[model samples]
Target: MTLHRFKTCATSFLAPFILAGVLAGVLAGLSACSGNEGANYEYDYPTVSSDKFQRQRLEELEGGDETVFGELSIGGPKKRGGAAAGEGFATVNYYLWRATLETLSLGPLESADPFGGVIITDWFTLEEEPGSQYRVTAYILGRQLRTDNIKIALYVRPKGTGKAKMDPHRASAVAEAKLENVILSKARTIRATQFK
Candidate 1:
């Protein structure tokens, strides 16, 4: 084959493959950049400790297992050792979980475990107060629709500019209590809708 004809055929054959590779790289880069954008918030909880009662309650409810709904098959055929039909087993209080997520929608969710009934949010800075940020960890104790079934831990931190260091602080008792009340109220509203 002539050099000119060989060169033309090679360029035509390789063009589509090269374009596909470049497109794939760009798409991968974009996805990676956006995948964990919620994890960008920075904060630390220094003195906060996990609640023993909550942990014990969760263990009891979960039957010491981390899987949701314990061994029950959902939306599919029954499995061995699974809950019987009409048993109505659930991992967490759906009302409380939904309410907590809606209340903390401003923050980026870091982790959520429905079986453990825990929702953790990354530090979120208020637009009006750039120097201050807050993080939240919420626990839905059980399936019961009760006020006491929900628990929350709120953490606040003040960012320092220049040479100053960031210091973490637990939100005030009153503020924490207020947030809990807000979540509970929202839960009630959501639960009410189910009946109507």
Candidate 2:
């Protein structure tokens, strides 16, 4: 074959493979660039407009009565049972959470886990005794607002000029028990009022 014809033949033979390689590379680049954009796309349910959903929720809550918006519903067994069941499933016991907070009001809260039902408080020092501080950890054991459903751990340490370490001997069981009693009492009071 002539040199010009040979060159043209070679070009035509290799063109399709080169074009395929370039197309594959472009597709790979586009996919890498779009990171996780389509991973959470839900095809089953159409997205609701936030403003319209909020307006509908407000109308349901208002229920054509401005004065009764904030009032707790009171009536026969059917009304009370459904509301109570719905509230129970949605979250942990509110009374126990409130009582725990109220009891630990003096201490600085470090971490509160609503899902795991754990509350940790930072070191709290008494005004009269600056040399000592206390830390508390409260655990909400169950959804029911019962005394056994709540647990507390109290740690006491003697404050030095440097970092204070907990002394096991200085820890008072009576003080911890007293605090637990107080929390349980408050929880009981809150539960009573809630049922009424």
| C-alpha TM-scores of all predictions | 0.52, 0.49
Best by TM-score: 1
Model 2 clash pairs are none
lDDT of 1 by residue, 1-196 (tens): 9999999999999999999999999999988888765577778867634697667655543332222343452423322345553244445656677888899898999998876788999988989889888899998886666767788898887776543336667888788789889998897787667435
lDDT by residue for model 2 (20-117), tens: 99999999999999898758875787779999998875553333111111233232111233446434222335567778988898889999876566
Over 4 Å off, model 2: 1-91, 163-170, 194-196
Poorly placed runs, candidate 1 (over 4 Å): 1-90, 161-165
lDDT measured at residue 129 in model 2 versus the true structure, 0 to 100? 77
**Clashing residue pairs in candidate 1 (N, C-alpha, C atoms within 3 angstroms):** none
Score candidate 2 by TM-score against the native. 0.49
Clashes in each model (backbone N, CA, C under 3 Å)?
0, 0
Residue 147 shift from truth in candidate 2, angstroms: 1.8
- lDDT of every predicted structure (CA atoms): 0.73, 0.68
- Score residue 25 of candidate 1 by CA lDDT: 100
